[model samples]
Target: MTKDEVRAKWAVAKRMVEITEDEYASHNVEAQAIKFVKTKLQIAIYYLSQLDEHGSSYTMPFTGKQMKEALKTPITKQNVKDAADWCHQCRLIRDKACATWNYEEAKTA
Candidate 1:
């Protein structure tokens, strides 16, 4: 996902969590949950930014024909499918396209 895409998702998540300045100031359990979610979002942002810096043309993390062939043990197709699903959910790869986060917009936001 691009940086803007990530930010858009973050905004959605933030709203879903209903983070408010007053709640943040209180720093209670709800605040902690928000912090945890924010941290995860930040990590995703960082990973996406790094991916962009490395270039979008790079190969996917795993699941190339060579990678599949290299496995000695019998690998279930589901394993690869699961990994791909997780990657997509994490925004590591979107629509099989390698994209990095746009840090400039993220920073400004």
Candidate 2:
């Protein structure tokens, strides 16, 4: 379902005394999707700020503290950490999926 639909369901669920299984699932999915989107956005901003040096794994490039400071909303440190962790997990998953080495040109990498 679309994010807006999920959000509308969640809002209605919040007003109910007892939520159904489907409502619970919708709320859960919405929460996870929100976090995933936020993490991706933060990842993009964090990496873009690094210019070309971000490719080097030797350095952290930017820390969670820096990200928090860079944010305008004054979010908590835990939120920043969680987003960074989620972004790192996404990166690792992509790398693992590409580990089959099925590419036609390996040297180009």
Candidate 3:
């Protein structure tokens, strides 16, 4: 997705966080989790915003040999499916967390 698309999605997530925070008591476990997530999202948003303002250029930590070896690895259909499954699982977990926290916006997320 484009940066604009990502930003739009982030806006929705931010709003959901705000709503969740307002609904739950601060001492509640779900509220605490949301608070933690909000902090993490804020950090990520800040980092990405900085990257947008500046250039996204950065040096890779991997050595040339390590990079070459990684590149040489053939990505199979199963590998791709596994990667997608992992991402889906992560989203499912997030959705479940949101649902457990009683965040209505979780449905749309």
Model 2 lowest lDDT segment of ten: 49-58
Residues 8-85, model 3: lDDT tens digits: 745753453243536355576545444544443444343443333233433322233432232222533443343334
Instruction: State which candidate has the highest TM-score.
Output: 3
Q: Mind giving the per-residue lDDT tens digits that candidate 1 earns over 54-98?
A: 345444353334332422234345444443443455464532343
Ranking according to TM-score, highest score first: 3, 1, 2
Question: What is residue 69's positional error in candidate 1, in angstroms?
Answer: 37
Sequence-dependent TM-score of model 1: 0.34
lDDT comparison, 2 vs 3, better candidate: 2
Task: Estimate, for each residue in 1-109, the C-alpha lDDT of model 2 and write its tens digit.
Answer: 3434434534432232132355345556444444444545445433332222223232333455544443324345555565566557545544543455446422233
lDDT per model, in order?
0.44, 0.42, 0.40
Pairs clashing within candidate 3: none
Ranking by lDDT: 1, 2, 3
